[model samples]
Structure formats: C-alpha cells, structure tokens
Target: DAGVTQSPTHLIKTRGQQVTLRCSPISGHKSVSWYQQVLGQGPQFIFQYYEKEERGRGNFPDRFSARQFPNYSSELNVNALLLGDSALYLCASSPTAVYGYTFGSGTRLTVV
Candidate 1:
C-alpha cells in the first residue's frame, strides 16, 4: 500500500501571508493527523480527524485549521503566517485513533 503523501514538498512565504498544505493518506486509513516539526524538535501534534470529523486538536493558535475529506485525504491551512510557523508539516494516517500511525515526508514551509 502507498504511504501518506504531502504536496508542495517545500514552500516559502512572507509573514502575514496564508498557506495551505495537502495530504493523502494510505488507502483504507480513516484517521489523519497533522503535525509541525521545528528544527531540532520533535513533531508537535496539530489536528486529528476521524471519519471526516475533528477528533482532536493541539495547543496551536486559531491561525491553524484543517479538514478531512470523505476519501480520507486532508488539508492543513494556516492564516497570518509568522516566522514561527516555519517548519516541516507532517501528515500521519492510521486505521484507527489509537496506534499505527504512518507519516508522510512532510511539507516544508519557510516563512520569511
């Protein structure tokens, strides 16, 4: 089976701009999670969607948002981007909410 895939593997934006990142989960996985990994740090959980409904959210600000499609794919959007938002955004997929998460390579966003 194919692993999770993310689009626009890299991006550059200025502060105050907005950006959207896309993700496609492995076939048959029903849960998707979004995470942000800053340099030299572990990925921080952002959002989780199950069955197309939001199941979990992290300590991120309102500038962050996400949605899951019926096909199990997902997208992460950030508004009013800031330099702090620059990081590698990851997409993870799992069959359920508990374990077995498979992650994508990530979309690297560089906020200048």
Candidate 2:
C-alpha cells in the first residue's frame, strides 16, 4: 500500500491570501489525521477527521479549517493567511486513533 501523500510539496503565498493543502491517506486506513511543524518545534495538532467527520481540533484560530472526503482523503484550508502560518504542514494517518501514524513529507508553506 502507498503511504500517506500530500500535494504541492512546497507553496508560497502572501499574507491575507487563502490556500488549500491536500492529502491522501493510505488505502484501507481510517485516518486520524493531524498538524503543522515549525522549523525547530514539534508538530502541533491541528485537526483530526475520522470517518469523514471532525473528531478533534487544536488551539489554532478560526482561519484554519479541514475536511475529509468520502475516499479518506483530506484537505486543509487557511483563510486570511498570516506570516506565522508559514510552516511544514504535515499529514498523518493511522488505522486507529491511538495507533502509530504514517506521516507525509508535508507541504512547506511560505507566506511572504
């Protein structure tokens, strides 16, 4: 089976713009997807979508939103982007909520 995959490995955007990031979970996996990782910090939990519904969300502002498709793929959208939003947005998938996750390389977003 293929690993979790994220599109647009790198992206650039200006402040106040909106951007969308996409992810495809591994086959047969019910993804509990999760976060963003800064250069020197551990990943931050953003949201978890299981069975096509949001299960959890972190302390992020309302500008961040995400959804899972029927096919288990997911998309993260950020509106009114800020420079602070620039980071490596990671996509993680696991068979169960507590199981180990397989992570994608991430979409490196740079806000100019």
Kindly report which residue pairs in candidate 2 clash with one another: none
lDDT of 2 at 87: 99
> RMSD to native for every prediction?
0.5, 0.8
Tell me the whole-model lDDT of each prediction, alpha carbons only.
0.97, 0.91
Per-residue C-alpha lDDT of model 2 across residues 1-112, encoded as one tens digit per residue: 7899999899999999999999998887777576999999999999998888898999999999999998989999999999999999999998876577999999999999
lDDT (0-100) at residue 103 of candidate 1? 96
Best prediction by lDDT: 1
Q: Which of the numbered candidates is closest to the native, going by highest TM-score? A: 1
Candidate 2 residues lying further than 4 Å off, grouped into runs, are none
